[model samples]
Target: MDDRHSRQSWLEAGLSQLAARGADGLSIVAVARELGVTKGSFYWHFRDLKDYRGALLQQWEAQYTQLAIERMEADGGSALDKLRRMLSLPAAGAERLGLALRSWALSDKEVARTLKRVDARRTAYLAGLYTQLGLDAARARTLAQFTYHALNGRFLLGDMVPAAAQLDLLLTLLTAPNDEAVAETAV
Candidate 1:
């Protein structure tokens, strides 16, 4: 809790606040108080609340989506392995922030647009992975949609189901051969 704070620190504080009290509670004054710093410290990093929010969104995009994709791509594994790795990645509090952002999106056009773009990027990445696993384009897209939907559903539901159980179901859907997967899962 130093007087001097980094932009990343401010963003992290913002996400934590977003999780605890929703977007309405996310403000420079609140975050500054949370960090035991002055408003000047927050202003040092961002031009204003709007600028802070934009940076926060960018950080969320990078941490939640772009970094995940990069890690999957860099892994030395087959498409199935990569897919498994991506699915099994730990939430690490990002899920709560994501849920908060989605809720905020319901009333904020800018947040809605950003969430839409993030979803598109994520689904496109999943589709590409399915394609690399030898699925046809249509099948890949379908699987991508299903996979992304399941992920967001889990977040929306606050993961009441155990993590192991959810992963088992997701891995079964994602790893099984296409025809067999459809037949077995009745999807």
Candidate 2:
């Protein structure tokens, strides 16, 4: 813990706090205490709590969604390979942060809107990858939705199901042929 904190450091602390305690736990005082600094340090980095929150949302969006899309696109593999890589990408703390934001969205319209936008961007990226794998538009969209839903569901279910087993089912669903995917979704 440094005496002085960078803006990024504050944002990271905010994210961790959000994950651990949800929106109500995110405060300048809390972040400052976590960083072993005074609240003045937070004010130095952000104009106010609103500004800090906006920056936190932007950081989450960039790190969780935009950077992920960049990594998948730059993977330089077959579309299927890229898709698998995207699916298996290990984002530590992402599930916690996602759950926190989703809970926050229930009480904040802005957070809900931001969450919706992020979900759309992620879903579109997955659909694009599926389209590259030669699935038609309709089927690609269906698989994309299913993939996103399964991922979220896994997070929601947490330890109720084994991670390995859930991942296996996800892989089976994602890598299946377009016809099979459509049929499975229909059931």
Candidate 1, 1-187: lDDT as tens digits: 4534888888988888988888888888888898888899887778988898889888888887898788778876887787766666556676788889999999989899999999999999989888888788888898999988877776666654447666667666665666677578845
How high is the CA lDDT of each candidate model? Answer: 0.81, 0.81
Off by over 4 Å in 1: 1-4, 160-181, 184-187
Q: For model 2, name the residue pairs that clash.
A: none
Report the C-alpha lDDT of model 2 over 107-155, residue by residue, as the tens digit.
9888999999999998898899888877788878988998788778766
Off by over 4 Å in 2: 1-4, 159-187
- Alpha carbon lDDT at 100, candidate 1: 91
lDDT of 2 at 85: 63
TM-scores vs. true structure, each candidate: 0.85, 0.85
